[model samples]
Target: MEDTTQLLPILAVHFHNDLGLATANTLAGIYVGVRQVDVTINGIGERAGNASLEEIVMAIKCRGEEVLGGVYTGINTKHIFTTSNMISKIRKSTKNITDGILKNKGTYEFVSAEDVGFIRASEHGIRLGKLSGRHALKIKILELGYNFEEKQLEDLFWRFKSMAGRKKNITDDDLRALILDETIVPQIA
Candidate 1:
């Protein structure tokens, strides 16, 4: 790989997640001074998928200072979840269209919702659901850049449960709306 880098202007590493080591291999390449890596959002790709962009970015952001000698990507980590959601929705829509043409509900659906970061916080190792505890909610809230007081979190949790009862899945958008509604102060006219 070192000799190959000298031959080319750019030595980008592209690895498939067939053995589920694409992210690790990508980081390995980066460690060896390869700056470019091919990655997909939510790791969705052909076959077993590709290296996860979020995983690589977060790994570098969290450990670059101490472990990787300050190697970092310019990715905005805050948009990771939203980008995953958008990709998941697009994939789902494409699956729906292909399913209609193929006359099979899952003919074009290769990845699971959880695999695409839908209804599950795989990075955090927590599955959000109606039965999720306050700790889980608090973690998600903090991840979304909201720092509510203890009492507010408690109140929000109850409201979350109320909304959760009606919906099969409460997405980040739902949570944001719930937070906004719960925290908004009404004024006297």
Candidate 2:
């Protein structure tokens, strides 16, 4: 509660998707002197969810590399995705707590039935994909994804880009084919 500047020299911003609070929180933390902060992947909360850890991390990189007077943390940035997955499992809601926190944690029924396949790892939910033409492709290659190296991102950009009048964005069917080609086919083919 005592978010005085001295208390937080670095901000671990838990950016929830409400009222643009995540960026605001990180900015506030930075203003208040926070240098490190807590975060999650897609802002998965017990109900309305929290902030996105990936965003704050990238924002730091953007400012550091471009605007923030040459200051970038040499973090193993590739692990950001894995870290997000882990936290989602850790801070996820139980099968109970349907009513509300404090007021409903004890009174409500189990709304989120894990037995029904509502997994703690929320892969079933609406997710981001490199489907917005090359825009998403570049974001995945340069900023997001599992095995993207910064140097390789440029090459990926060119490789995935459209030629002449073609668009090189990923599609739902394209993703399905990739899944079948890489994951499913490998298992059975």
Candidate 3:
């Protein structure tokens, strides 16, 4: 065992959902000056699970941003969804992980592994809307930007509701283009 103060470069903690180690592992990383973090989405681990990529990234964004001295996250907020898709494709290809949501299409779109940078194969994490208002708005805003006002959002909401009972009624294909546009931020020089 090494002193956590020295910040040993190599430390692998098994993930277990019994205690929610995902959040714990991320905080541990912060406890130590870890530049490179190891994480997976949904905390898929050998036994219980490992830390979640979203948890780590969100923690970094919440705590590391503008603080933690020289700590700077290497994730692009806008590309998060696409990146998750790419990671999923890679995992599927490698047989490391399973695609749980590929069954759902049209309503949303996901990227392929090549879309990210997974030349090799490995298991990774994915992010999605988790029944939270923020998640829904994030999915929308990620694709469409802030162009849609409250009224338009309300309209879309009502439209979704109107089609709620229909077998198939999401005829709005324009939203896909918006999702694709959820990339780099505008250069503000």
Candidate 3 — worst ten consecutive residues by lDDT sum?
120-129
The best candidate by TM-score is 1
Which scores better on lDDT, 1 or 2? 1
The residue-by-residue lDDT of candidate 2 on 1-189, one tens digit each, is 875867643434555656758665764665555656666566565556566555555666556555444555566556664565566567673222122322332244232223223333122221223323443444333232334455554454444443212544354454344333433434455
> Which of the numbered candidates is closest to the native, going by highest lDDT?
1
Each model's TM-score, in the order given? 0.50, 0.35, 0.40
Model 2 bad stretches (over 4 Å): 1-15, 65-73, 81-189
Total colliding residue pairs, candidate 3? 3
Ranking by lDDT: 1, 3, 2
RMSD score of candidate 2 (Å):
18.3
Q: What C-alpha lDDT do the candidate models reach, one value each?
A: 0.74, 0.46, 0.49
| Candidate 3 residue 116 C-alpha distance from true site, Å | 14
What's the lDDT for residue 32 in model 3? Answer: 66
